[model samples]
Target: MATKRNVSSTKEEGPVIDEAIERNWEIPDFTIKEIRDAIPAHCFRRDTFRSFTYVFHDVAIILALGYAATYIDHLPSAPLRLALWSFYWIAQGVVGTGVWVIGHECGHQAFSPSKAINNGVGMVLHSLLLVPYHSWRFSHSRHHKATGHMTKDQVFVPHTRKALGLPAREVDPEGDGPHSALEESPIAMLYNMVMMFVFGWPLYLFTNVTGQDYPGWASHFNPYCDIFDSNQVSEVYQSVAGLLATIGLLTYCGQVFGSLAMIKFYVIPYLFVNFWLVLITYLQHTDPTLPHYRENVWNFQRGAALTIDRSYGFILDYFHHHISDTHVAHHFFSTMPHYHAEEATVHIKKALGKHYKFDPTPIPQALIKSWKTCRFVEDEGDVVFFKN
Candidate 1:
């Protein structure tokens, strides 16, 4: 069992830690049943028609955008054409991510009560987005089951102090050990952010970057990868088949439409979809105020509470289906559909009280802040917060 240190004694004995970092990081006393009870029963009901409506709504916008792009080249002014194409990329990327979110809902069986319907829709949508649907769905289930568990959570698992080569607590009790010069440099940070937004998703899918370490190969594409069970190998292969089919389709489209047209119509906006996916997930789980627990201190209720809710403003929130704003509720009740998440969130806040974390910082500022501050956690604590 992991042991907890007295917070007051630690402050007095070592160098002063930031007061803001000194939060109530103890394990929550509440039960998961209590949280479930807090939410209204109706919020748990799934509406298949309403779910399909959103899927249709997003697909219609994407089709309209594609149709609008056909006229961009005919515009008399080059500058106007360029500006509109850029607008189309950004707009389509945003809506594309909303489609991705719906697929995610389907993976969680929140889109409908019928598992087959959910999987069928989720498989097609995610496969179109180049995601291996069943592979990600299975691994993502593990992520939720063990969110904020230091050794167990699947993605965005923070590096430990020792893993990063930071000095031991006894050697640098103040935790003032300097980070590598390159890591602290602003230019390096910018470069890293660009690389992350552009390539992070592919790297994660191919190499399991930012995910838990496993023996031998660990990839979303590998049916035998450690992230899945023996029984799930067939499903993993199905995901792979779906991904291959999508790739074949895209290859055909690129040849038929010409590569530049394909790039303009698909690739650039697809990159933006990757950008939004990384940004939203990174900010949701990575914050200095959030705590990750060692096995002895970890529980589903506590892990779920560690998630942070942030507003991406009204417009983005609507398009993205409130994924950013109501994440805490989603973590607690993964089966709850997005349309009803906001209603459930109100009750979740009351149930969790001080334990529920919400950050109101504008997303751009919050992204920078988390990237700079949430580097790694201490090696020894039962409950540890990220340290710069």
Candidate 2:
């Protein structure tokens, strides 16, 4: 045997080059081909059968949970029954939201290779959830295409105080003494969170609450809305029809089960679904590390790289199909099936090295931190990062 050497004397070098390169926001020398080469060829292939298996699996659990809630509602013990029912709603809501993620995959053409199958399933699932599928699909596509573009991004376009006709001094308050008017008071924060979780998604869809500001009133469901062009009118109308059908279905359910029963079973869980949707998207895009770029500095690769990967715990990861964790890869290859996204993400992390942003912070803490820190950007630069 050879004598043992003191290898500990020679230390590993830090990733200094990678760290410096990550901060270089101009453009990257590394091409997309390098990333593609890192991933296995099989990861690019979509298997419709396997995709449907997940859809069916999530649907079965959702139905079982719904039935369980009904049984729990009939239980005699008031406090125990209420506790069980609350747990059931939370469970069903999360599982149902996972189903919505699959529908989103369909909209991205990742559910299957067949566009017809993708559209058909997406329309059904999203419509039942009160999302106009075609309308959301088109707008979400635009978001992906222009992810980091400040002025062009369709959703969560943060504006300067001046743009909103508020004084800059109001946003950047005098000293560290008191919070700015834009800062939410503790009670107000709680109320805002409740309202956001309950009605944010529907309001955003119908009224463009946090979406891009258009010259006139803009609504996602309006076929002639500036978000869509003339060619998209038919698809928008189809989406409208689907939403109308879902409303009619809700009406029938209310009539049969009574309003309170309907609210208990369907409405509350629906709200939770919207909450998950908005929360996931919000956290994915809005982070202090990510910079929003103007047209002069924006490009597809840089825009796509702005997304962050988050950990949502293993059990929830399985339930949510790893959407939170594998979001970076999803942005890069939007048509790649969710089953393959994790593997793809591993390869991307390898390729991106220090440039890949993964935040392991617990979601609640992360959410609060982002809400406090990521208010708005300045009006003067080609690149803008969040402030206060």
Candidate 3:
């Protein structure tokens, strides 16, 4: 409801680097030299394609899982069928995380050496899940650039008391306040769901509702928008084509397996796939402790700089790198592939120290902790960056 503008000046903010560790934060000339040394030494550089081996393997695994699901009736007992169904849903969610990563790579222009390839790959993967690739890529890149900044940061930034105004009711940022209003009201929930990704992608394509208010070519699914600043309509076409192809496949699967069987094997897994997507993305940005900037205090750097790195530990290491686990590093150096993120976090932590925060306890504890202590509005005056 507040129509404030961003008025914070970079001059008032002082230097970009913290003075105490500014000298130490340097890539250490030796390390920079060492990092540069490997550029040409390795057969693949950042832009170079790494054989597409993972893509093939991932696709093959998905296919194999699909096949297994299709034949779940072949299982000898009820328990086996139940086990297979459980495996299918969880595996789909996990694999779907990879799929989102590939789309994210498209956002970074890292999925393949060519923009053409990245767009093609990104659109297909994202579209199959009903996301609009260009819409997300545009805002997402801005999110990376402005991770922890108080005001301009995208996704979920914690709101300060001044931002909320003294008269406003204090409520949970993730649930009662923003969420309840968004969910319980059709219009509000429509906006929330759209902004939050349930229906955000397509609406971005068709409406350009929640993202940065780029006036000109922003809403259309066309290539004119700045987000499409990376790829072309060919990528959009691929997404459409993927839908068509999937429709054909679904039709065939249904005909051969019958609607109920297909529902058990395919539709259920497909629906469940995005549930984790919603949950992962929701928890990543929406902690009550996280800050969202009011327009005046919101600066690009401050908003973007605010994020918490979550520890999903071994599961994230073995699989979901693109999820919330390595999120802090991802926010800082987004162009780096998820594959390189875990390694980079070590260097980053040594440099960032307290600036880097990790919720080491199981997410369940974090969730409950967040619900209780994180309630209500934090004063911008008192909000502490992990460094303090």
> What lDDT, from 0 to 1, does candidate 1 have?
0.89
| Top-TM-score structure, candidate number | 1
Model 2 residue 140 CA deviation (Å) reads: 0.3
Q: lDDT per residue, candidate 3, 213-234, as tens digits?
A: 4557665455566545555566
Q: Which residue pairs come into collision in candidate 2?
A: none
lDDT digits (tens) for residues 24-56 of candidate 2: 543444666777888999998988899999989
Name the top lDDT candidate. Answer: 1
Q: Give the TM-scores of the predictions, in the order they appear.
A: 0.94, 0.89, 0.67
lDDT string, candidate 1, 182-253, tens digits: 776889989999999999999999899999989878999888879999999999999999999998999999
- Full-model lDDT, candidate 3: 0.55
lDDT of 3 at 198: 47
> Ten consecutive residues with minimal summed lDDT in candidate 1?
11-20
Off by over 4 Å in 3: 1-44, 47-51, 148-151, 157-166, 169-256, 294-304, 371-388
